[model samples]
Target: MKLVKEVIARFPADAAILDPFSGTATTTLTAAERGNSALSFDINPFLIWLGNVKCRSYSVEHLACIQDDARLAIGRVPSLIKNDNWVPPLFNIERWWSAGTLQVLAALRAGLVEVFGEPTEDRTDGLAWVAFCRLVIETSAAAFNHVSMSFSSETTHHEVEHVTYLYLAILDAVLASGSAQLQGTGEVVEVDARAIPKMGRRFSLVVTSPPYPNRISYIRELRPYMYWMKFLKEAREAGEMDWKAIGGTWGIATSRLNEWGPNSKVLPEILTDTVGRIAESGGKNAPLMATYVHKYFYDMHLHLSSLPNVLEPGAELHYIVGNSSFFGNMVDTPAILAASMQMLGYSNTVSKIIRKRNCNKALFEYDVSASWPG
Candidate 1:
């Protein structure tokens, strides 16, 4: 948040801040706090919902009502889960919930749905769900070392009061902290960064920290949340989500090649370069490496294309980027992306490398890099 504020300070007060790939709407919210009109979009539906509703202004009365609703949902949790008629047939009914705990969550979810519907009713609903989502992780049976959603049967933790109280506390804190006031009026759209052009909007500043090419697969890392939202199951049933995608870790660094074919030439070049390197690697992990490169370049292309439409001429875009060595190969994504943006009709001369953190990279001392629109 502090870094975002510092970078934002360089722009004007009424700057239309935009984050084309707003993972969790960090920049979007920051813009709102500074009284700037903020717009953001993400490929993840859950994230879109989270950012959109959380950033909207809310009333104290509305928050209080949601709090009461949450309590009521908690009260009816156990019974709601046990009622066979309400359970989704495809889910493992027997293991879906830990009897009482599942009931609580289900009831809470049902109550929210009853009041506001699942997609989120208001800012308060967003706050409640955020709190609930965090609780789900902490109280879940998933392993600590593995961020994946594999539960451990040997672990036994009671989820009744603890989880409920945790959710309430978080919701209270989010509301009390004046997040709603800070957020103002903002919208979170569920769309790929590549699809930004279709939205046809422009901004004063575009601030975002896109996923580094060598970092974790974002989509895969978010499987648990996807599963919770039942999107995984829906996609699996519809043949949209399959083993290949799962194995690829939810299309983080890999996407269907055809998706990028229509885009600018930048993606194709990056993909070709990355694929050549992976082939040179020549190992079983070759496939994973190829996917990473493909996804990275494709996303970069899509992201850059959207900015031209959404940004005013010479309006600055600050990207927090990092360079990393993957499989002992240096992928100069920062320079490449900046150059790509330049090629796409944006100037790329005015930028700086502000170090926020660092890693053991002999060539570069910092993990953070800053850029301004050319």
Candidate 2:
């Protein structure tokens, strides 16, 4: 975020900043903090809701009103969970959590719904809903369940008694710390990036960290949240839910087998050729690798192609991307994405590696910088 802020500072514009692939709405919210008009897009509507609500502010007085309502709403939780027919039958309630913990969290969600009454347009209602949902992950009985960290295969978490109030309490601290950031409402539209032409011609500054190969797919990674919000089911039922639409291999594989990406006209063959070599070493996971490479390249291509049309010519585009390793072979995702941007007429100005605590996503979380050509 600091790096992004720096780039935007050099450009210096209060024009409509855009984050086309806005995941958590980091870019959009940051821009808003700087007083820039912002537009954020994401296929995941749940994230849009989170980002929108996070960037908005509520007063202590207003929160008190909502808190009172929250207490009343929490009272209905027992009945809600008792009637919850959809709470994964396959989930090993015994192995994953204790009955006590499950009841507590479930009750919390029910109480939250009772208080907020299903997230209306009012700012106070919106914040309460977001707060309640955020608490779900924090209070969960499972260890490291917040966004796919290392899982202990030997010891499974099953007791609902393992609930923690710290998650909600910490959330309260975070909300209070940045009380000012949560002032206004930002619109979140669940739509395709390719179809963005219908919305507007250009944006002020574009900032995004698109998906990287071997990294968890955004759709799959955030599936739990999406399911909670009721968007994923709707998409699946509407026939718009496919592998590619959800950042899966089927969509990506289809792209690679048929020339695709920002440099599709030039780099598709190269990517295909490289991926082919990596697949040749496959024993059991060969098919999986083939599919992964295909999807990664194709998705990256789409992002590169979609952005230029949505941003003002020469508008600064800050893309924080990195490479990936599959079966010990390196796929230069940042370079590939950069090349694709150039293929679509964006200039590669800067690409730098940021040294950070490397997590499970990739070997590195380097920042690859670029600018759209005027």
Candidate 3:
């Protein structure tokens, strides 16, 4: 958030901000709070919903009513869980949550749908839904500190008192955090970043953090939430969404591996060399990693090429990206992306290393800042 604010401060007071990969809408919310109109885009429906919920205006009366509705929903949980129709996708209820806990969650889900109705584009019910999602995670047996969702060996007892107390606390926090004045108008679009140019809208500033080229799949991390929210009804649907994401690895098919060729003219030589080394490693997963790295740059190339259409002359772009190490080979993602931007006619393209972390040695995060030629 500090970094977002710093970048936004560099632009003029009335500069329009665009975040093409607005993960949790942090960039959009920051821009709005600073009195700048902002537009955010994310391909994931759940993320888009979350972004909208964070940016939307809500009344204290509506929030209080939601709390009351949640309390009533908790009372009806036992009966709601008996239907057996609310099972999560690709999951056995007993594996992740206690049977009693799952029942309470099922009831909560049903109650939210009944009280809030289906989520609309305006997302009037989004706050209630987000609160419900928070309850689902906080009450579950999954270890919150872990990178992936894994059930803890020790069981968690979730009685009515515990569940309702936690739910209400979370509800209050969400409301309080969102109570600030939303100074600027904001919009979140569910679309691919590559297609932004086609929208034919121009912005003075673009701030985003694209997915790193690491093999970690965000789809896997988001599966539980997506299933609970009904954004994905089955495992196959989850896979489809993963395939559409920028740097996805979990659901990529073997046939699509060859679609992105071995070399990219726009990317830096360091990236090409890393892909070559990974491909030559001869490990079972080597080819897959190679293809993923190649495709990452290819997609960025297309995204950079299209930026000129939507960015005003002299528009500034700040991309927060990270480097990755796969099979002991480094892929300098920000450097490669900066190189691609320069190739696409962006001026003053430079990558500044912002922070370094000791992740399996050293991993660096960078701010790849550039400008469209005026």
Off by over 4 Å in 1: 78-100, 121-124, 143-153, 178-180, 198-200, 235-275, 350-374
The sequence of per-residue lDDT tens digits that candidate 2 reaches over residues 248-326 is 4333433343443233445555576657767886645665665567666776677567666666666776677666666
**Which residue pairs clash in candidate 1?**
77-103, 202-310, 203-310, 347-374, 348-374
Models sorted by TM-score, best on top: 3, 1, 2
Give the TM-score (vs. native) of candidate 2. 0.78
Give lDDT: candidate 2, residue 89: 31
Model 1 deviation from the true structure expressed as Cα RMSD, one decimal place: 4.5
Q: What are the runs in model 2 whose C-alpha is more than 4 Å off?
A: 75-90, 93-95, 120-124, 145-171, 181-186, 219-221, 228-269, 356-362
Least accurate stretch of 10 residues (summed lDDT) in model 2? 155-164
Best by lDDT: 3
How high is each candidate's TM-score?
0.79, 0.78, 0.92
Error of 3 at 331 (Å): 0.7
- lDDT assessment of candidate 2: 0.58
| Candidates sorted by lDDT, best first | 3, 1, 2
1 versus 3: better lDDT goes to: 3
Each prediction's whole-model lDDT (CA):
0.60, 0.58, 0.77
Tell me the lDDT of candidate 3: 0.77
lDDT of 2 at 277: 64
Error of 3 at 183 (Å): 0.7
Tens digits of per-residue lDDT, candidate 3, 204-278, equal 999988888875667787777888887888777766776777787665433466565645465667667878998
What are the root-mean-square deviations of the candidates from the true structure over C-alphas? 4.5, 4.7, 2.3
Return whichever of 2 and 3 wins on TM-score. 3
